[model samples]
Target: MIVKFFKNSGGGSANATMNYLLGKENDREGARLLSGDPELTKRLSDSLNFQNRYTVGVLSFEEVNLPDDDKRAIMESFESSLLAGLDKDQYNMTWIEHTDKERLELNFVIANVELTTGKRLQPYFDRVDRPLVENWKQVTNHEYGLTDPHDPDKAQAVKTLNRQNLPKEVQQLKAQI
Candidate 1:
């Protein structure tokens, strides 16, 4: 399955960000907040007192995939997607998974923008996320076939079972059977 990502911008955003992600607040408490690092999350929030920071949001494909079940894989995939687009190296990040919502999603609180080259650190959807997601879809589809129900095309949806049942060697195998 594929994962989708997005971004947002704001200030004092950390307290609110942490609260939302970690489920400290009232309405927010119900979400899974799958990641646990309260100390690191607090540190990340503390790191962004003055400078700029962007909230990089991550959303899983409509259907959750196996990797989604692994915290390490999810974190790695999230970071990989983040780094592949931006050149920045030194930045603080904290992400929380939203499971109780309509769709499974993750909100990454990224701050402490300290890129050596001083380039922008905020993730641009088109420039960074799209290509990554598209490439993931292509590669995974190529290997797994795009028919997974979560795939954009619903490649193997039962509604199209006719295609799955088609015989590849009708003439050659009819008599042998």
Candidate 2:
């Protein structure tokens, strides 16, 4: 499981983000809203009058394909852990599930305005929040037995043929060739 944050557009609007998440801008096959109300989220952002109206990101699950129930549980866990400090009612989040790739992906758009105070809320700050997010990814991966992005062995290393180190079958086949 990997938590990847998208670079927030300076002038990003909630409606635009919602449209992208909803696959209006591009053809996203097998994409569906997992949670939250798009219209209400947009309305909340629109009411705020902030330039950067939302934070957009995706939680990518590599190699492990999960059922819808498990996916929802994972999503809830990730969201709750990632936004632990924020009260439930103070923020709004919209989750979209995408399974077009080999792994499952949950794309999210978080409205930046605090519902209670109408104040700008940046969900993630690089210097402060990155470690927390990274820790969450590591812990969640271990707990769910998902792929660990931090594992060096999990990375695809470039291969070069070592003639002497070839397997017996490969060496025999090569000799015949």
Candidate 3:
């Protein structure tokens, strides 16, 4: 599974962000809330005055189709592994599942504030948390036999470097070369 993180705009962005994730904007199909309450999550985020109200991320599985139960289990395991330091009650995570694409995606919005003390809870820090997150991803991918994100050769862009996936203009330019 490939992990991706999206920056949260500000305290008020949580409302709009939740709306988009819950498909309130486009009336998008197949976007279902698998866990947590959006309203409560927003409230928790707003309670603490921080530059970033929350953290948004997506767990994208490589084209291997799995049952909903299996996916949920995987997500649970991922949360446990990544956020082991934070207690379950300290932070609130809103999980949404999208099946519109070829790969299954588990999107999550975690409120940065702690529930008990209203303190900030940053799950993945760059310099400090990189090794832990990377190790987890590598071990998880190996355990599930998923595509290794660290391997450039396994990437779709590298695999199709003939420029077939690029836009017409880019493809034409490549052909001209």
Give the candidate number with the greatest lDDT: 2
Candidate 2 global CA lDDT score? 0.78
Return the number of clashes found in candidate 3: 0
Runs in model 1 lying further than 4 Å from the true structure: 1-7, 25-30, 33-39, 42-51, 64-71, 84-90, 115-120, 123-125, 137-177
Q: Considering every candidate listed, which one attains the maximal TM-score?
A: 2
lDDT of 3: 0.77
| lDDT winner between candidates 1 and 3 | 3
Residue by residue across 1-177, what tens digits does model 3's lDDT show?
888777545447677887777766636676777888888887777766787878888888875477778777778887888789777887899898877776778889888877788777887676787787778878878877777877878556533435565647866767855
Give the clashing pairs for model 3.
none
Report the C-alpha lDDT of model 1 over 1-177, residue by residue, as the tens digit: 455543344445566666766656535643554554545646654555554445545645353433444545556565676566544245556666666655555556565455464344554456656777666555554554433444456464443225555557877346434
Give each model a TM-score. 0.53, 0.79, 0.78
Regions of candidate 2 where Cα sits further than 4 Å from its true position: 25-27, 156-177
RMSD of each: 11.2, 8.4, 5.5
Model 2 — which ten-residue stretch has the worst lDDT? 158-167
